[model samples]
Target: MPLAVVDAQTLVDSVALGAVYALMAVGIGLVFGVLRLVNFAYGQLVMAGAYTLAFTSHFHPAVSIAACFAVVIALSTAIDLAVFRPLRGQSPAVMLVTTFALAFLLQAVARIVDVRDGTIGEPVRVVGRLNRAVDVAGVNVRQVTILAIVLGVVMLGLLALLLGRTTIGLHMRAAAADFRTARLLGVRSDRVIGFAVFLSAVLAALVAVVLTVRRPLVTPAYGLQETIVVLVGVVVGGLDRLWTATLGGFAIGFATGLINGVLPTDKTIFLPTAVFTLVILVLLLRPGGLFAPRGAATVERV
Candidate 1:
């Protein structure tokens, strides 16, 4: 890799991508922490939000964004109630399969809804202004890229505060640490899990907004690949620890973006191949997780 080829713009964009992945990592990790469920359908929540934004694009930007949030959160809640809550005691493999099924079902439904308007995809016009670039220290940066970084930092900070200072947050932490013991100690399992779903949904909604600002087209598979990549990062970073999982997400995203920048334009199509090869190398070196604590046993969570 030629260091001279990677410019300030690439660095900024990579950080922004990492920030977005970090948010997704936190979302996925939140549910996994409490329920031991990977929630493969998480990207569907983002897809729903993106579709909501597309459908409501004719409305005021505030209303469209608000609708996006409402739709994603509601869909997430519905999935929790209809599927996850019912299978709470099932084996992890069963739950994982359920998520896979739910993901495909949601995608099929999205495709149907999309083609009902005689189109395979919809454009989100509400936030197109975010595509505009602004000069930052002599480097041009997209407004949405800046927003992603800011949102990631703010949300992570807020999450840290919530987990550290609030009662529900403490309850959640306790539940994540040891669900059976926490329940024995009077922690409400349903409430903690429900709250986790809600937080994850919020993050999905935020991710949808940021993603649409970058790619305005809302397709059935809009967030599918990103979710998969983030899952890889979460596991590679150490699913056993939330911070490690988040760091993994950010690291993978940064690496992907950096690699894309370094690769020749014609070879950029091989991006996924290169990224996964790097992932294989990382796992070979640190099977437990790149950010996991030294001497901690590696346990598969999902």
Candidate 2:
């Protein structure tokens, strides 16, 4: 294959993978920008969504997908209200560890649920994977991938509009810019913050279905990796800038998948390191993120 063709092939695959990551990263980044703390159990949200899909897929697949989305968002909101919200005034370190603990609890729940159900998790087909391919500049690519990319674009656009053009969006922006100012302006900062957390969960839930459809195979162990990717994208993109997070997720997905394909080894390793290394360099050269900073910006670009 020509060098250009080879590179292009890898890129297409990367973007397909990136669409899911972009969804995930934006969620993490959105939470961090709004509430300067990490939600370690965020991955569990995805896992929960997947398992929800797994169980429901047998009955009504469409309903299962909807249930998964609803469950994730509701669970995420519950976490904010029940756990994180109570610890609102705590140190960042405390919040981080709390979120981490939440992750463990979620995983344990998954383990117990799976054991009771007598099943091991794997990718459940969301839509029947089209074996059909459309030739894209000599590469016979799967049609599903193209469709997935289109969906990703649409979601991102909708989210952008939701954030930019809505009253809820205005409240979110006001809080993100300055919580105190937001309160002074009658924004009810606490409620505003709760909304941010709710939105975070909803976005994370959205990623769950997107990913299950894109690559359904997942185990409880997958939660850790998903958490890391979402967090990494948040960090790399500059937490405050939505586009940066989106770009960062897509960039990492592309880089990781591309490297996974090109390496001579039978198994993939070091892609996370390689991706983070690039992010670190970007941070050293341009702190905050590739985009401008907002709020306290705990999401260092590196």
lDDT of 2 by residue, 1-302 (tens): 23333476667877887887787777776776667776777788888888787767676667877888788878887888899778876877899999888898888888887767577665566654543578987987777678658867987898889789999888877777776778788887667777777766776766676666656666776557867875676666666666787787777776666766676455456656676796677567656666655444443333
Question: Which number leads on TM-score?
Answer: 1
- Candidate 2 has its poorest 10 consecutive residues by lDDT at 293-302
Q: Enumerate clash totals for all models, in the order shown.
A: 0, 2
TM-score of 2: 0.85
* Candidate 1 wrong stretches, greater than 4 Å: 1-4, 265-287, 298-302
- Model 2 CA lDDT for position 198: 71
Give the alpha carbon lDDT tens digit for every residue of 136-204 in model 1. 999999999999999999999999999999999999999999999999999999999999999999999
